[model samples]
Target: MRQRTGRLLGPLLVLLLVGAGPDGSGETVSLDGDRPGERLDVTLTRVVDPAGRADSERLVAVELRLENTGSVPYEDSPAPAAHLLDTAGQRFTGTAAATGAGPSLPDTVTLAPGDSASGFVTFRVPAGAGLAAVQFALDAGLGDDVGHWSLS
Candidate 1:
């Protein structure tokens, strides 16, 4: 199976080493369409909303939705980690310039072949910090497949 690697927003890409966990399940997305003669389809959906928490801090509200759109059932991949980056090459969390949690959101969820779940990532930004963009990617390092790599 070809390894899947992607960048978050950009640069903040999610690096998932192969055999990340239990042998990966489910089929790979051809990016073209569903396999021939197959009646089952799986889809991963995500929504990212950045909101201000404090005067100098901000948080991005991310909602991940997984659904088995087809008539069949199969194990789904884990979602990736979401991160935020600034202009000066600094992680969003509390560093020298910025002061807050980068993209270490608390997400412990897994959806069944037909079930759906949601999670959130809290980003703490310091006052007067220059933020360029937010990134998202599946850090297979987390030992899961729901990296939810769509909102990029």
Candidate 2:
């Protein structure tokens, strides 16, 4: 009976894995045209507001794509900081008081020439979290081009 159960689960797992497709990031992305040694090309995608549809408390996340097209590699501290500007223009992270807080995971990355990375910028929205615009700023290893986004 156990052997039969294992056989059934194997095919199911394979089917599930095969169905997951590539996310929107794919072959058609273009890096910002900046002079080498200038800055990283950051393309803001979406802001997942923590406030639920009803504006209750939930997890807020920002998503963007960062690519290094410069002559030298992007340089940053061991753990540089990412600041998220809430609707009120207050920083959500990296300030004395976390007006809004997000998961403090590793939250760091570096890119060699022509390297690109994508993921969500997660945070905790205050009780009165707004579901609109959130601005993001990167301290280092990034270019002058800032990222902007709006949630539904």
- Candidate No. with top lDDT: 2
Name the regions of candidate 1 deviating beyond 4 angstroms: 1-50, 54-56, 66-80, 93-106, 139-152
Give the per-residue lDDT of model 1 (tens digit) for 1-152. 22344434455656553332121223232111132221212222222334446665655433333343334432322223444455566654211121132232223434344554434455565655555433332322232222212221
Residue-pair clashes per prediction, in order, are: 21, 5
Backbone clashes in model 2, listed as residue pairs: 39-143, 40-143, 101-124, 102-123, 102-124
TM-scores, in order shown? 0.38, 0.51
Q: How much is the lDDT of residue 146 in candidate 2?
A: 33
Worst 10-residue lDDT window, candidate 1: 30-39
TM-score (C-alpha, index-matched) for candidate 1: 0.38
